[model samples]
Target: MSVWDSIVGQQAVVGQLQAIVSGDPKALAQSWLICGPPGSGRSNVARAFAAALESPDRGLSDEPTNITRQVLSGTHPDVTTLATNKVTIGIDDVRQLILTSEQMPSTAPWRIIIIEDVDRMLERTTNVLLKEIEEPSPHTIWLLCAPSAQDVLPTIRSRTRIVNLAVPSTKAVADYLMASVNPALPAERQFDRHVAVRAARLAEGHIGIAKLYASDTQVMSDRDELIVGLLGLRKASDAVLLADDLIDTAKSQAEADVNRQTAAAEADFRRINGLGEQDRIPPKLRGAYNAIAKKDEIKRRATRRSRDVLDRALNSAASIYRDIAVLQNNAEDAVGLINMENRTAIAELSARLSRQEVVDRLEAITVARKRLLGNGNPMLVFEALFCALIPGRL
Candidate 1:
């Protein structure tokens, strides 16, 4: 697809970028602060902009000399994209971009640099970038994507043009899904507009999760289990099981990552230092060495955050149950959960749990999330949390 066709429902962003690429992008439209909830089109917008800026001669191409395709493959000489993959984009990365931007593009129409998750950029790095943005090169355009404009520093926001992309309408999403799905599936196999809308709304503008729900029964079941587990009796067994599941997930990710890095580094080291009197120590081993050197912090953060993700799933379920508890009170009216299927247990809990008890437990779940982000103890926090939520054997 041409650059503009990729953004599903955002005509304005598409138009704005087209104009900019056609060399009439409004002078006022520098440094766009594209913000949206996670899974939204934030990164896509930045990518689209980069594609436009790096457009190769569309009508006439030299077989393989296309800048747009290059940018798409993440190999464009003049376009640099940074995301969470790099632990951090130091002042050096930004400074290098500044230097690259100053030099004329080797191939692309213009120099486009995309800083994804701009919020993750350290303050010092952000400061270094600000200098470049303040007086950017004529051929350079910086596209910054953040979860919220507020996520970027105040001073940084003040200097840039802001383009707020709204969540796609449900009708838009439903229509898009219809086009994306297979036609061979019977009409009865289709999702009604209502189901598509619910999935889209809950997804908060992420087409990926919306697609997951439509394509994977497992995803839907996972969501259901997550909600139900939270509201169910806080059994000691359930808490332990949940924590163990998370522990496995986190450990598996870390070990697999270490293994992949170790293998790649070892190969490169061996290739460079062939046979006689060569070094056996793989270069990639250096990274593993550094990681083990910081084992305390790495293990601490990963274990806690994984548990937090698990606990948050449980807490959401708990909230579902809590609402039902409130409902049994029947105070005037309640904003109810139409999706909540396990209402019987909710009603039973209402009779047993005091309002204060429900509220406090919810508060504890929130504390668990904070502690996880701050790198708290995984087992202790969740274990104690379960003890609080679960009724004790007196």
Candidate 2:
């Protein structure tokens, strides 16, 4: 129940950070870079470390405590967490982080700044804080998280201590999901041990995705539908249509997300400014408020949508190829299918397609992902991706 307890399958990392929290000089560092695959709890560890630094007893508790909760919720005065919902973390964002780094802690022993997705920063933006990261104040600490050290620039990478977290085993992920979160699910939504293990296997060691598949029937259905659509692929026209369909779906989901975020931001702004439900902003301040909402908040969400949608679609496409590869190699029993329930369709597809073709298709998916990240038009990128999935297509 201590801050470290929530981190799963990272005993080495936990032990190291715990030593630092306990004032072990040998374990302390001014800056740290924590790298892990998606859902490997990079941010969780960073925030937990922050909590440990701020807590009066240095997270010595054997029970869950409010200090960890406050840190996670972004209410702790001593901790500043920088997370971008945008496509990239810009210079302005890094400057803001730098500004906070200069400030001393209000009450805690250190002023801890945790930046999630440090890999998202532009090369120029990352360069701006080289000095600060290398030479922060004695009471300041920076905890940066990304998918890998390679994703970060060498300059920034060299300045920090590195902690790499491996993907946990399927059994480990399933056990945590079933034992911790699944039991608290409402009766109608609860998943049994069988379902939990299946979800964990399907998610391929991604804890967050495993939880989604276990708890949400609709997400599982969507995944099933996507897999079925992938297996049904035949020729050029179908691939094009499928690409259009996936892109359109992503756009719709992004629009819904944007609307939800906008509404929440407006509501928060009204509450802060003492405005009522029906109140209108005064003309003098209206322009400023509108600018903040449009340029800063909503704009960021739009960029995030582009990347998120593409990543999701790419992962879905990649899963099919991965299953195909397993089936083609006759390794079904040795390395079970990710789409386990679709074994029949997978076997049929394996019979129809060469293993090399499947590997080529996966390579195409990787190329398209890079193009999309490079700001290639998503429609064009997806069109190319789907067409490539059909071996004989343009």
Candidate 3:
């Protein structure tokens, strides 16, 4: 399939990008701001654009060429991807990006730079990028992806062409997940279409989450357990234990993910330094390796873990309030439940709590979410949220 085919429910975006790649100078821009909600495939579309820019000879071919494959896999030298795992993208990071942006394309028509979370940069950091982005080399192209144009600074927003991506429909997400199934797998190993639809509905049109729910049994089970436990919080003591349990679950998931990432980082460092089984690093380079191994990477990874775990847990928790709101307002016909399988439990909550109480709980969740996103302590945020969730009883 064409590279753009993988981006679902953005036919207009695909058409525009295809035109630009096919020598339509009218559609070309030195810098582009791609705006979309999380899991709306902003980065994927940006990468596709980069690949197309680098592979003009491929000409929208159904099969991916080597250039397209390399760009997608992040191995193409001409394409630079700056993705931050930290709380903020620092001025130094922006300086490095600016430095690289001035370099001419090594092997492609454009030296494409893709910044995945441009919204994470501080104002000062963004200011550092303003000049370079506004006056990039003729052969350099900048692609910035964020939740929305509003997330970025006005200076940066004004200098770039904006493209918005809409969340794909449930059918679109399900169809894409099923189509992505490996053809080499046997019938027994293949995912059922039924599972795809259920997962898509549960994920609320988030393609990444939908695929995880469809493919991973443990993820599905954990989500069910979390939702069930949330609805079962009746007593004050029960809320405490459940809140602790939620924190523990998030910690465990975070630790597991962090361990895997650390291992991968270590392996990559070893390969890059050409360290063998017995060879010792030179004294001069020892400090550098240690910094990479222990300091910078570990700190960044920890920050990432905290943010990811908190965000995941909060999202799941928020869904309970969302489902309750839907039931309380008799809007079930308009919006589907993310936890539809636990409808009985949700219905029980709706019967017990008034519409205003449900709305209040949602407000608590929203406040907690904002605090966590602003680097508040996860445990503190969860404690307040959990207590508020069971108001009178807690």
Candidate 4:
């Protein structure tokens, strides 16, 4: 009946975690890897362990004493969590996490650190982390989560114990949705159900994604339609329109992201210039011009990527519909690389296309994705993809 019990379909993982809980978790080696598919509760399970280790049940009390409250929150002696706030977790952040690992807890009995999306850590970050993992820290523990065990470095993986969370079934996802949504919601309304269903269908056992899909059906619908359209290889007018839509959207996202990065860079630049005015500017600050230059470069890359993302989004939209077309025609399973959302549509479209033709369409979409990421011209990529999708039609 502990908090760990709530995790669904992860019996083996739960057993392992429970054993770790029963033993001297603080004394245990400070490193462990929790591997699971997306939405499989990897982070949740890890957090639950951190909470229990920090809990009063373990006899340690790192109580939270705020101005207004006593946050008995996981009263464990020492626990710190690090994760990606940006799109990537670079080396600097990982270095900070490692530095903190060397410190003694301010209050908690045991020191625990959780790194979510450990796979997202850049190469430099991972390299810095390797040293910390290799060293000893009796009171400190590390929990890293990733899509798979292979996602991390061999040295890091070899040193740590591993726990794999189970992928819950659709029913389990649905049941979770039933319990997780707002209770005040009208009984007849199936908003949560719709989301859970879509996530279950698309994410294919990713609880995080299922919840996301369930939480925002409209967005999912829009995303699904977009993918469907792109893959289906619509008309020239449609392609132009899709390209325009993607370009506009990418422009906005790129600008925003660039602005944020630019602002951070400019702030540092100003601080450096001020220091120089007072003759306090260090070599590092003076060298920060390179940093500023790099920021601009990254902004430009992101700007370019925005266009690519828009194109990919459209391609994904087309693929979904193409899947429907093929599925309807009794097309071979080979074409349905991912979830087959519209079986009826696939069956219907299959009537018009040969099995090879449907498979070709799917392949075209895949090629489109690769081309975009590889800096393949989007206009040309989309054009080629459309031509292939439509066959003899121009």
Cα lDDT of all candidates, in order?
0.64, 0.82, 0.82, 0.64
Please provide, for model 3 over 1-394, each residue's C-alpha lDDT reduced to its tens digit, 9 standing for 90 to 100.
6778779778889898887788764447989999999988999999999988889654388888899899999999999999977668888888988888999989888899999999999998898899988988888999999999999999999999999999888899998888884243456556788888888887777788887778766666777777777787766676677767777766666666667676766667668888864677789877866765575666566667656656766788888888888888888999778788888988888888887787788778789988987878777787778777884632
- The residue ranges of model 3 lying beyond 4 angstroms of the native Cα positions read 181-190, 258-303, 391-394
Query: Worst 10-residue stretch by lDDT in candidate 1?
Result: 56-65
**Model 3 lDDT-worst window of ten:** 181-190
Residue-level lDDT tens digits of model 1 in 1-394: 4755545567776776666666644553556678876666778778767766666543123343366677767887888886754445677777877787788777765677788888888898898888777777877778888888898999789888877777766556555665665343456556666666666544445676565455544445665665555456467888677555545644654454455555555565556656233455457555644554365755565554444345435544455545755575673154444344666766676677777777777777777777765657776666666556774421
Give the runs in model 1 whose Cα sits over 4 Å from its true position: 8-12, 19-28, 56-65, 86-88, 169-202, 213-216, 235-237, 246-366, 377-381, 384-394
> How would you encode candidate 2's per-residue C-alpha lDDT over 155-241 as one tens digit per residue?
999999999998877888888888887888888999888988888887788788788779977656766766777777787787778
Full-model lDDT, candidate 3 = 0.82
User: How close to the true structure is residue 254 of candidate 2, measured as C-alpha lDDT?
Assistant: 64
Task: Residues 143-205, candidate 4: write the lDDT tens digits.
Answer: 899989998878789988888877887777767766765343455644756566556656556
Best by TM-score: 3
User: Could you tell me the lDDT of residue 113 within candidate 2?
Assistant: 93
Candidate 2 lDDT for residue 355: 69
Instruction: Show model 2 residue runs off by greater than 4 Å.
Output: 23-27, 183-186, 251-309, 328-334, 375-380
Q: Give the TM-score of candidate 2.
A: 0.83
For candidate 4, which ten residues in a row score worst on lDDT?
Answer: 64-73
